[model samples]
Target: MTGSLQPVLAGVVTALVGFASSFTVVLAGLRAVGATDTQASSGLLAVCVLSGASAVWLGLRHRLPISIAWSTPGAALLVATGPVAGGWPAAVGAFVVSGLLIVAAGLFPPLSRAVAAIPKPIAAAMLAGVLLPLCTAPVRALVEVPALAGPVVLVWLLLHRYARRWAVPGALAVAVVAIALTAPPARPGSAGLWPVLDPTVPSLSLSALVGLAVPLFLVTMAAQNVPGMAVLTGYGYRPPFGSALRVTGLASAVAAPVGGHAVNLAAITAALAAGPDAHPDPDRRWIASVTAGVGLALLGLGAGVATTLVLLSPPVLIEAVAGLALVGALAGALAAALAEPDAREAAVVTFVVTAAGVSLLGVGGAFWGLLAGGLMLLLFRRPRPATAPAPEDGGTVAGAATPRQPGRRPGRRGVPAGR
Candidate 1:
């Protein structure tokens, strides 16, 4: 009983930490994309249920700790992209398209390879650019509303210094307290507490497809799915990459009409369930992911409340918390983006264009950033000399034999015979 309970507790913690750490970012992204309060709530609920289901299915089917999550980085991309040409419906359509792209990547190896062939530094630079503004929100909040944001920042700092893992959550708790104290109390029976799916009829637009869908798919694949597989591999689990992508892609498509943006494999939260802390035996760690899936599904029921909290709180305060959660991600992205000296200049171009948040010709900064970076890389990258094929057993160069003395080997120059 104790053995079973340990994994269950770990799973619960995984779900809690995953949800608490970044749900604000999800909401903010949905809002930025023009989702209404109710729509954002529906998006939250849908992703939780879909991601939870994917996690549960993959964990059981593969018997591996395959954790799933909504694409937090993709959400950040949406936040950066802001409203599209056709409003929220177009965004929904873009979500559907991105889901299809993910499914295609899973089904077609060439497509997956094409996506993988994107230079890592350029991808990381684009992500870093998208993350820059959000990561600065905490400082802005500190300056703008010090009284409300001060305690939250202080708690986060203290915990960040000592605990690290609980830093964002600690800050979130204080922010909740501040909200409860300052914000007006909710009237009884004013809002429903149960999860609600407010479906929208998706309408496709060229700009949304190019600017939103493409970038969302790329960001989700590069930042979330890839890192997720790496996390599982690090824990000695060989993730079923194709199957995971298919499952998550299908879930994202199904949930998109109802406001869910995207769902993919979990990266940071994966370590919780896949790690030894969940189980003494590695083989049994799947139970932790399964339990976490159920917990996340259960947590989906509270989306209404979570949405209400966001609607009630000052947006900047919530942004500050979300920003705090993303600082580490930003740092990691920047480091990876600049790691290759040859790619540094191109990466900088990508980062600058993306961080500029400028839109041109109806396309978002992310797409432009990547395009500019790729061009820079192509134009500025130094060409390498062609590698020559290795010699055969006789050490010939390009099938041409070297002249040598009749009694001598290749490296016995000036030596007496039979020495």
Candidate 2:
């Protein structure tokens, strides 16, 4: 009980942070895609439940902080494709495709290798590019609603500098309290809190699926799954790739019918919990992730409460906190990407292209950033061969114990040949 308490507490905090960071993004994306409030709420519930379960299962197995969540990039892409496509049914097809792509990525070694080979500079550039819009959104909202947006921004800046770890959640708390105190009028029919859990029968259309599914799948794999693997490897834990992929895939498949679009490994949030604060023993930290899973599942059980919070929270606050909290990650990731010499130019190219905000074939800049960076490296660099040094005094300099020249025996230097 003594040793367990800290891990349990750490896990609970991890889940709350991860949920707070990701849940609003998913909800906003769904609403943009034309989901009714009830539909969007249900979708978010499915996402949290699935993420928590899979993260716990994986974390318990590896004893690593293996967090899982809905794909932020996929949600962003959905914002674009959802309205163009018919509705939720089309989105489901996309979800299935995303799962399939993730599975394929796990199974294919070459793809992983190629992805790993991407220069850090390029990856950083791409990440910065993706986050740019999110940063501006809050400022834009401030123009529309200064009372709510202005305070949230100030809170975000204060927390980011002084108490960054709590910035987003804290700002969100302040915004909620302020809104409650103000008691703004709610538009009729917008204020109800019920989210129907009755699963809708699955449907598919080839045209809609092809257009929507391909992009969604690509976004999930390139933006979320690839980076996720990078995060694990970067931190020195080599997960069983096949098992992780299968679990995420299975989780996504199960959750889709209930409205979750994609479920995958969490890079940023998992990294936070995996750090020293979560647990001293690397092996023990998984308990935190497992705790998060259980907590998420419990939260799912009270879907009404979760729904109410999301509904009641102002969009301006969500944007401000999310953007400011993520500012640190964006900086860190970009620095890593840019730190290396050989990869610098290509990484810059990837960053520029992605930041340009050009979307081709429904794929976002995150994917293109890596892709362009890879191309730049291929075009510019050539692999050099390992250098083999000549032996000194007939001894192999490359760690061979025996003398290379037969009769020229061993000696510290010119001490005549040894017997």
Overall lDDT per candidate, in order of appearance = 0.83, 0.62
- Clashing residue pair totals per candidate (backbone < 3 A): 0, 4
Q: Put down candidate 2 lDDT per residue, 1-419, tens digits, no spaces.
A: 46667778887887777676556667667776566677777778888788888988877666666667777756655544445344666666666766766666566756544543444455455655655566566777688778887877788778878976577777777777776766455632342455456355556655546555654655455456655644454444555556676778777877777677888766556565555566766567677778888887766655555556656666665656556545655566566557777777887887677666655564444556657877998898677688895332211101111212233322211112110
TM-score of 1: 0.90
> Which candidate leads in TM-score?
1
Candidate 1, residues 1-419, lDDT tens digits: the string is 58878888889988998899999999999989999888998999999999999999988888888889998888889888998999999999999999999998888867765776788889889998888888888999999889989999999889989987688988999998898888877542122567789999999999999999999999888888777766665555556678888899999999999999999988778888877789877778888999999999889889989888877788899999999988888888888788889999999999999999898877889999999999999999888688995432211101111122243223221111111
Off by over 4 Å in 1: 186-192, 385-419
lDDT of 2 at 124: 53
- Clash list (residue pairs), candidate 2: 120-337, 121-337, 121-338, 122-347
Error of 1 at 301 (Å): 0.9
Query: Against the hidden true structure, what lDDT does model 1 obtain?
Result: 0.83
